[model samples]
Structure formats: C-alpha cells, structure tokens
Target chain A: DVKVTQSSRYLVKRTGEKVFLECVQDMDHENMFWYRQDPGLGLRLIYFSYDVKMKEKGDIPEGYSVSREKKERFSLILESASTNQTSMYLCASTSGPAEKPQHFGDGTRLSIL
Target chain B: AQTVTQSQPEMSVQEAETVTLSCTYDTSESNYYLFWYKQPPSRQMILVIRQEAYKQQNATENRFSVNFQKAAKSFSLKISDSQLGDTAMYFCAFEGGGSNYKLTFGKGTLLTVNP
Candidate 1:
C-alpha cells in the first residue's frame, strides 16, 4: 500500500506567523501536489513538484510556496500567514501519467488566529 | 481548461439501500479520465472508482460503480447496499491525458447513510 504522511494533523498558528506543512511519500512517485480544501471550493491546488527543487504554481498560489529538497519530502510554506490562510491542507503523490490516481495523505487542519 | 460540476451538495440514504451522486463536466479534450473520490471524517482522500474516456463500459468496484455518459459529459457514482461507513464527502474529478496530470475537482457532495 502507498502511504502519504503529513507532519501535523492539526495545527494552530498566530496571524502573520511563518508556517510549514510537511508531506512525505514512500512510493517514490515523481509527482507531488499541495492543495487546500475548503467547504464549497473543494480542493484547490497550491503548488506541485515534479522533481527535486522544482515547483510549479497551481490555480491558487498567492499565499503559499513549496520546497522539494529531496525526492520523498515536499514542504508547503506560508510566508506570512493570516486568518484567511486557515484551511484543511492536503498532499498527494502520483507515479506519473494521467491514468494514475493520486494517493493522498490524511489532511492537516490549520487554524490561524 | 477542464471543469467538473457536482450538483448535489448533500444526499442521504438508508442503510442497505442505494444512492447515486450526480457529476457533470465540460471539456474540449476527448481523451481524459474521470474519477470519484471519497473523503470521510478521517480526512484521507480515497479513490472510489475511475472511468476512462475511451472505454465504452462503465467502471465498477465492489459496491461502487460509475455511470459514464460520454456525449453528455456526465459521470455519476452509484453506491449499492449503502453502509454506515459510506458516509463521506464525494468529489468528482477530471484528469487530462499525456503529461498534464493535475486534477480539476467539483465542489463535492456530502452523503450520509442513515440506519
């Protein structure tokens, strides 16, 4: 079975704080993605990495950035988090190609106060 | 650009019954993939079923199945013998072929199975 792990299941941060959410996948998949899930918006992609040190902006990337230092780890960084930044964050990975389904991690629920 | 639409925001079903969640999409590309994903309270997104655009037959997995209407651009999921654990938010997604692997998702439908 493929396992995608998120560092924190629940996180609380003060407004304007720098926050990091880490994701790791064991399947050696070539594609990694970060998304924020809201009530009606579904999951909006934030950023994605196809290789080490490579990143691409998704539909919603204004308040977020990402880092893929190694093949297994991808990190989402909130430069200056605000109250609106609070949401459920999800990380996913795929082996590549459109036919492959992404394996998702148990999301991190972040609350900014 | 690809877009997915799941109209039913919330649905309820009795245990041991059946329920269908509606999904529609708009895309110019003929070659693509459609998927139904389940997210329970656990917060992990699980693939419920997948349907290939080229394939004429619908995709089914155990109690979960998909009705794929190619010309109408609709993909609906049918869950039979609904169980207690079937309660979750179901999302409809579209994926393009070739190197474009990112998914475009619908708003999602929250389904609750009642006893």
Candidate 2:
C-alpha cells in the first residue's frame, strides 16, 4: 500500500502570516500535487512537481508556491495567508504512468484568522 | 482543454438500495481515462473506480461500477446495496493520455446513505 503523509492535519494562522504545508510520500512517486478544496468549488490544483526542482502552476496558483527539493517531499507555501485562504488542502502523489491513480493524504484543514 | 461535470450536487439513498451518480466530460483527445474518487468526512480521497477510453467494457469494483459511454463522453458511477460507509463526496475526474498526468476534477456529488 502507498502512504502519503501530510505534516499537519489541521492548522490555524493569522492574516498576512506565512504558512507551510508539508507532504511526504513513501512510494517515491515522481509526481506530487497540491490542491485546495472549498465548499461548492471542489478541489482545484495549486501546484505540481514532476521532479526535483521542477514545478508547474495549475489552475489556481496565485499567492502559492511549491518546493520539491527531494523526491519524497513536497511543500506548499502560502506567501501571505488571508481569511479567504482558509480551506482544506490536499496532497497527492502518483507514479510516472499517466494512467495510474493518485494516492492522497488525509488533508490539512487550514484556518486563517 | 478538458473539463468534467457532475450535474448532481447531492443525492441520497437508503441502505441496501442502489444509486447512480452522473458525470460528463468534454475533451478533444481520443485517448484518455476517467475516474471516480470517494472522499469521506475524513477528508481522505480514495479512488473508487476507473475507466479507460479504449476499453468498451465498463469498469467495476465490488459493489461499485461505472457506465461509460465513449461517444457521448459520459461516465456515471453506480453503487449497489449501498451501505452507511458508502456515504461520501464522489468526484469525477479526467486524465489525458501521453505526458500530462494531471487530473481535471468535477465539482463533486455529495452522497448520503441512510440506514
């Protein structure tokens, strides 16, 4: 079984503060993704990393950045957290094959005050 | 650009009953894949079933199955003998063939199963 672990299951941050969400996968998958889930909006991609030091913007990338210094870890950075940024964040990883299904972490419920 | 649509926002079914969740997608690519993901209140997304465009046979996993129509670009999920554990938000997703592995997901359908 593949295991994807998120560093925090829940987080609280104040407005204009910097926030970091960390994710690690034991499967050594080549692809890692960050997504935010909001009510009625479902899950929207924030950023994705295909390999170490390689990142790509997804549908909604504003105010967010990603780091992939190693193959097993991917981090999502919120430049300046706001109340609107409060939502559930998910991290997923999958093997190189496009047909493979992604394995997701438990997700971090972020709250910005 | 590829987009997935789940017209039904919420659905309910009694235990031991069957329920179907509809999903439709628009894509120009002929080779692609479709998926049904289940996210319970636990907030963990789990893959329920998958269908490949090239395959005519519908994909099934236990009590869950998909009705895939290639020409219509329709893929619906059917859950039989639904249980309380089956209650969750179901998302329809699409993945294009070749290099791009990113999945485009629908807004999702919240399914509730009553005992």
Candidate 3:
C-alpha cells in the first residue's frame, strides 16, 4: 500500500499571513501534485512536480506556489493567506507510469480568517 | 486542453439498490485513461475503477463497474447493492497518454446511500 502523508489535517491562519502545507510520500513516486477542492468546482490543480526542483503551474496557480526539494516531499506555500483561500487541500503522488492512479493523502482543511 | 464533466451534482439510492453516476469528457487525444475516484467524508481519495480508451471492454471492480463509450467520450459508474459505506463524493477524471500524468477531474457527484 502507498502512504501519502500531509503535515496537517487542519489549519487556521489570519489574513495576510503566510502558510505552508507539507506532504510526504513513502512510495518514492516521481510525480507529486497539489490540488484545492471546492464545492461545485471539483479538484483544481494548483501545482505539480515531476521531479526534484521541477515544477509546473496547474489551472489555479495564482496566490500559491510549491516546493519539491527532495524526492519524497512536496510543499505548498500560500504567499498571503486570505479568506477565500480557505478550502480543502489535497496532495497526491504517482509513479512513472502515466496510466497509474494517484495516491492521495487525507487532505488538509485550511481556514483563513 | 482536456476537460471532464459530471452533470449530476447529487444522487441518492437505497440500500441494496443500484445507482449510476454519469461522466463525460472533451479531449482531442485518442489514447487516454478514465478513472472513478471515491472520497468519503474526511477521508483520502481512492480509486474506484479505471478504463483505457483502447480497450473495448468495460471495466469492473466487484460491485462497481463502468460503462465506457470511447466514441461518445462517456464513462459512467454503476454501483450495485449500494451500502451505507458507499456514500461519498465520486469524481470522474481523465489522463492523456505519454509523459504528462496530469489528471483533469470533473466537479464530482455527491452520492448518498439511504438505509
């Protein structure tokens, strides 16, 4: 079984504050992704890393960035947290095969006040 | 660009009954993969079933099966003998072939099982 672990299950931050959401995968998958899920909007990709130090912007990349310094860890950074940034964030990892399904973490429910 | 659509926002079914969730996608690529993912409340998303465009046969996983129509770009999931544990948000996703492993997901259908 694959294990994808997020640093926090729930978080709260004040407006204009910087926040970090971390994720780690035990399977050493080459691809890691960050997504924000909203009601009636589905899961929109924020950022993805195909390899260490390589990142690509997804559909909704504004106000957010990502880091992949190591093979097993991927981090999402919120430059300036706002009320609208409050949502459920998910991290997923998958191996080399393009057809393989992404394994997801439990997700972090972020609240920005 | 690829896009997935789940027209039904919510669906319900009684225990021991069957329910179907519809999904449609728009893609110019011929080779791709389709997936159904289940995300229970406060739980991680898990893959329910998958289908390959090249394969003509529908994909099934135990009580869950998919009706895959490649030409129409339609893929729907059918759950038989639904149980309480089946209540969750179901997302239909698409992945194009090659090195790009990005998945385009639909808005998702919230399915509730009544006991």
Q: Best DockQ goes to which candidate?
A: 3
Clashing pairs in 1: none
Per-prediction DockQ, in order? 0.79, 0.77, 0.80
Residue-wise lDDT of candidate 3 within B1-115, one digit each (tens)?
8999999999999999999999999999989999999999867899999898999999989999999988898999999999999999999999988635889999999999999
Query: Which stretch of 10 consecutive residues in model 2 chain B shows the poorest summed lDDT?
Result: B94-103
Question: What lDDT would candidate 1 get against the real structure?
Answer: 0.94
Per-residue lDDT, model 3, residue B13, is: 98
After superposition, candidate 2 runs with Cα above 4 Å error: none
Q: Model 2, B1-115: lDDT tens per residue?
A: 8889999999999999999999999999999989999999888999999888999999999999999999999999999999999999999999889635898999999999999
**Model 2 misses residue B83 by how many Å?**
1.0
lDDT string, candidate 1, A24-97, tens digits: 99999989999999999899889999989989999999989899989999999999999999899999999887
Higher-scoring candidate on DockQ, 1 or 3: 3
Q: What is the Cα-based TM-score of model 2?
A: 0.98
Error of 2 at A101 (Å): 0.9
Would candidate 2 be rated incorrect, acceptable, medium or high by CAPRI criteria? medium
Candidate 2 chain A: worst 10 consecutive residues by lDDT? A94-103
- Scanning candidate 3 chain B in windows of ten residues, the lowest lDDT window is B94-103
Candidate 2, position A4, lDDT: 99
Q: TM-score per candidate, in order?
A: 0.98, 0.98, 0.98
